[model samples]
Target: MNRLFPVWRRCAAVWVTGGLAAVLSVHAYAQAPTQRPAQSATQSPTAWTTSWSTALQEIPRIAEPPPLYQAPAVAGRTVRQIIVPTLSGTTTQLRISNRYGTRPLTIAGVTVARSAAGAAIEPGSASVVTFGGKREVVLGPGMEMDSDAIPFKVTRGAPLTVSVDAGSDAVMQAWHRIAGRVSYVSSEGRHAGDIPAAAFNVRFTQYAWITRLAVSGEHKGGLVAIGDSITDGLRSTFGADRSWPSELSRRLAAAGATPMAILNTGISGNRLLSGSVCYGDSLESRFEHDAAELPGVHTVVVMIGINDINFSSMPARRGLDCDTPHKVVSADDLIAGYRRVIATAHRHGLHIVGGTITPAALPPAREAIRLKVNEWIRDGRAFDGVVDFDKALRDPAHPDRLKTSFDSGDHVHPSDAGYAAMALAAEGVVPGAKR
Candidate 1:
């Protein structure tokens, strides 16, 4: 896909070129960890726990990429993003990546400050973000780097304005598409410390470069909500913390449950079995990095397999066939996959929970698979615990469909209230969580 090893226009190997000359000279070095090494429990208590994060996907490789993949030009622009990181943090650190890029991604500088309003940051709260004690860093293909810890305070769900000034000639090639939050980009030039929000003219929701924000703390571990678009909180109200995981976070605070980060690692269209260029690597392939490898993740709740069951029916597109591997799945195949994931979590010494597939008004045949899978999830006792999301949002009258009040209108994704209900159901099952 010319994404990893770029295929340049070399057919014109300079047919008797005259005096013209062009040299692509870009030099920047990245200083960050590909993976934050897990802290041993017996070690010192001060460790890093991810405060907030979203999954990244290699942009769809098709020539005519979709509107969503048309990542805004960041070569010489400053992008100001409103990061929603309310998980506990005292001494915070950041992660950035060029994990799927052909061209190097470089940032001249990054500055974080308390968000005031749309694209506006609090005047005096700005702090510089450094890498290996330096301001600039470059990431080559398949690389992710974490920043040096910054002494900033991000409390329970407060918003943060992360301003990044792209190094000269940097290009973006990977992104987290369903940001479900608002962010802005400057027209041109560096605006990393622009507190007035005047230079940030362009706006977008997708997140680029930056990945995880972790805080070194003595707090309890976190809960990771990992799944498909439903878990991604798709179609939920934008800029509002309406995702089930967010709602779960709210409940934890209200109930006085042990304070832990509720990190969301769900990617829209992601599947448990098949891989897609559009939706990230299959969960079975990415589970380690996305879930098990995070610093202080103690529990993980898995809600997937719906896409694995339904994508087989989607008609193939001529260009980007995101539905490929159209490999139809049976209940047995999914149950086997779950067992593998469960074993992996156990190996990592993390407790894993299973969530029943929620209701989606599907045709009878496919619906059967979902029902059977949920049955196995409940009865098989594969996970350490279970969260019956289907029971929470399904219509009592129809069992096969979502409650009308819970439907996000497409009949698959959940509405805000529906997500809240999911959170409530999850609260009851996760031990000690009572709200």
Candidate 2:
């Protein structure tokens, strides 16, 4: 070890030989890490790969839904286009319904487009949608259909133009009151031999009914609209997309936002804390199924509670419940119930926007409770945000009643125009969710 070598020879051995060995080791390991075990095609025939094309082919095909009821004389119209607000550059789904029609209906030529000035006939550059088998469809009475998938590049709250063409003088059954994705369908097609929109696949052994139209793209989460009959659009004409939620959905699309999927959980007699007159679950009891169960839900708009006060005080409906002549619920009880619902939603990180109970003085007692509860709801005691439906809809002269201009003949629910106003009130908070 002590023997001295020629100075230049010693230096060359230490620097050049050691550096070359280190470099060779590193290069060998890098190549080794990338090397994979090759399979023999003769032995395996097919080798598994992580490529996207192989994964797509391996996925199972989704079967269609079932057929609904049908009659001879009546029929529903065809949905031509559906435009919805979505997260800009996101994809979404569209739902078509005949839930209220009396007979079977045929559907053909479904498309999407940007909202135009007057012509509801032309397909615009913004339009792109496809049907099953790229062919026309037929919906049975009281049934629905979900079209083949579509990709939407939604801007923040852009206006999506939707239209339909009736094959005959057929009336389409849709969500008459509320704007949502759920709708009814008919039982049979236009004729026995017509291409059925709702069919059962023999190969897959599943119903081929298109109950939901889902559009998924680069958008963010969606919207869940919860409320009563006014939000439901009870007095609006059938097949007319005039409900407040529908209008709100349209407005959301116009803003270049993700098209919000409206899950209409509004029951005619739904209450805030108590049972309903229509024999369904109360708002409190039904919350789990209606609001919590919706897919892709990011926000909830709650505009209910008037029915709790109205139906409880109705003398004609008194005998249906308990021995007490009436069930008068206090504001405290309603607030407590709301707190529970809010807590549950917050656990899931959902933003809840509360809507004040609408003005309802027709029965007098109902009006008093509405005012009391709305005061608490507006006081920032319950929800994440407040939409003052009462102030927007209340009459200037008669503060206790709905505005005469906005009231339907019944005075309880808002007319189509009034619903539009409510839609505007919650527009800023309800429809716009950040990406």
Q: Estimate each model's TM-score.
A: 0.89, 0.55
- Model 1 lDDT tens row, 117-158: 799899999999988778888776677777777899988778
How badly does each model clash, as a count of residue pairs?
Answer: 2, 69
Residues 141-199 of candidate 2: C-alpha lDDT, one tens digit per residue: 64544444455544534454443333555643332222323222323232212122242
In candidate 2, residue 55 scores what lDDT? Answer: 3
Cα misplacement distance, residue 166 of candidate 1 (Å): 1.0
User: Residue 64 of model 2: what lDDT?
Assistant: 25
In candidate 1, which residue pairs get closer than 3 Å at backbone N, Cα or C atoms, i.e. clash?
32-146, 86-157
RMSD of 1: 14.8
Model 2 score (lDDT): 0.48
Worst 10 residues of 2 by lDDT: 49-58
